[model samples]
Target: MHAAVVHSFDELPRYDTIDVPVARTPDEVVVDVLAAGLHPRVRSGADGTHYTSEGTLPMVPGVDGVGRTPDGGLVYFVASDDAPGTMAARALVDRRRSITLPVDTDPVAVAAAMNPGMSSWVALRRRVGFQPGGSVLVLGATGNAGQLAVQIARHLGASRVIGAGRDAQHLELVDALGADEVVSLDGDDAGDRLGRAAGDVDVVVDYLWGRPTEQAMKAVLMARTDRSRPLAWVQVGSMAGPEIALPSFLLRAANLSVLGSGQGSVTTAGIVAELPALAALVASGVLTVDALAVPLADVEHAWTRPVRPGQRLVLVP
Candidate 1:
């Protein structure tokens, strides 16, 4: 079998022949890889930067993917934190960790959307306890995950979805993806604009943390018309930066709750529980994402290419 093998954490994965994965436990099942996404987490794992990185050498470097079993059952699976992952001709996955998909589902799109899509889906459904017809503001709404967040929020019964991003064009694009309003983060008064737009928002799904997050927090604080109204701030990703100096007044002055989602914060079963519904949405065309499917042999080149906003690069094995 061939796979994207990582010999050293410092170097890029080399696509070449490697030993096939063997199931060591009774609960594990081996599935032929169809398409795997090059998510930022996967890249971080390859670079030994993700918290889950095991510091093991000579291993495959994918966290999740869509694949088919020997009996022709289609499934999406998440790899164990320490095991060789999904960027290969085959992967060994725990049966409990895999979700069966419809036969007609597009494997490439599912592979591309699941990880990024899960960031917000799990946060809204589990962590923040999203209410039906509630208003949502997505802070980094131009990114792939943010775009999906807008759509998922709408699908989950958000009455108003505000998409906020630095890219004007991408913000416009998110409007088509179910965002009721779009806010640009380019101007000096962007925070003020965000405050006004978020005045009545019930939940905020934040993908970018740092200056944008700080601005959003200030905006929320400034726009609070009713201090009694509850607001849940769910932090999913930090593409902007890792740290922020949050004012203590923001928490004290309003009914605001800050929570982080993903990995250790959300249980593995909790994340996997939402996949079936999400996969159904994607398969039924209620949710969609722009994906480029490249051959596994082209992993090196595809990995280095600059990803456009809202676009995902999927490796087809």
Candidate 2:
């Protein structure tokens, strides 16, 4: 079998022949990988930067993909944390972790959308318990996940979706993706712009948690006109920076609740439970993703290429 093998953490994965993974337990089944996404998480794992990285050498680098079983059953699966991942021609997948896909579904789109789509879907549905018709503000709304967050928030019944990002061109597309308003984070008044947008929003799905987040929090604290309405600030990713200097007054002054929704915060079962609905949405075209499929043989060059915001590079084996 062939795979994107990571011999060293400092470099890109080499496309070479590797031994096929075998099922180690009765619950595990070997599947032929059809398509795997080159997500930020996968890139971080290959670079030994992600917190979940195992630090093992000579291993496959993908975390999840779309594949087919020996019986020709198509499925979307999440690979084991420490096992050879989904980048290879053959991978051992735990049966329980795999979800059956519809026959007409686009495998590459599902492979690309699942992880990014899940970031907001799970956060809005499971973590914050978001109610329909509420207002939402998506921080860092230019990235792939953030783009999907804007759409998901609107689909889940957000009356008004506000998208905030640093890119000007990409920010223009957010309104088409269901964001009622968009704000730029590049200027010095970025905080004030975000604060003005944060007025009375019910849920804030934050992906960038650095100075942008600090400014947004301050803006929300100052601009919120209603004290009775509850506000849920769900932190999903820290693309900007990890830490923020949050003032004590921001929490004390308003009905704001800050919480994180990933890995430890949301259970594995909880994350998996939301996939079927998201997959169905993708299949039905209710949820759309911009993905480019690259051959597995081109992993080295494709890995280093610059990816535009809202576009995902998928590897087809």
RMSD, one per candidate, in order: 1.1, 1.2
Per-model CA lDDT versus the true structure: 0.90, 0.88
Q: What TM-score, computed on C-alpha atoms, does each candidate reach?
A: 0.97, 0.97
lDDT of 2 by residue, 1-317 (tens): 99999999988899999888888889899998999999988988899998887688887889899999999999999888757978878888888888999877898999999989988999999998889989999999999999999999989998999999999999988878888999998988887878788778999999999888988788776887886578999998999898999888777788889899877788778777888999999878887699999999999998988888999999999
Error of 1 at 149 (Å): 0.4
Model 1 over residues 1-317: C-alpha lDDT tens digits? 99999899889998988888788899888999999999988998899988766688887988899999989999999998756889999999888889999999899999999999999999999998898989999999999999999999998899999999999988889998888889998999998888888788999999999888988888877798897799998889889998899889888888999999989998888888888998888778888788999999999998898988989999998
* Candidate 2 lowest-lDDT run of ten: 220-229
Given candidate 1, what's the lDDT at residue 295? 96
How many residue pairs clash (N, CA or C atoms closer than 3 angstroms) in each of the candidate models, in the order given?
0, 0
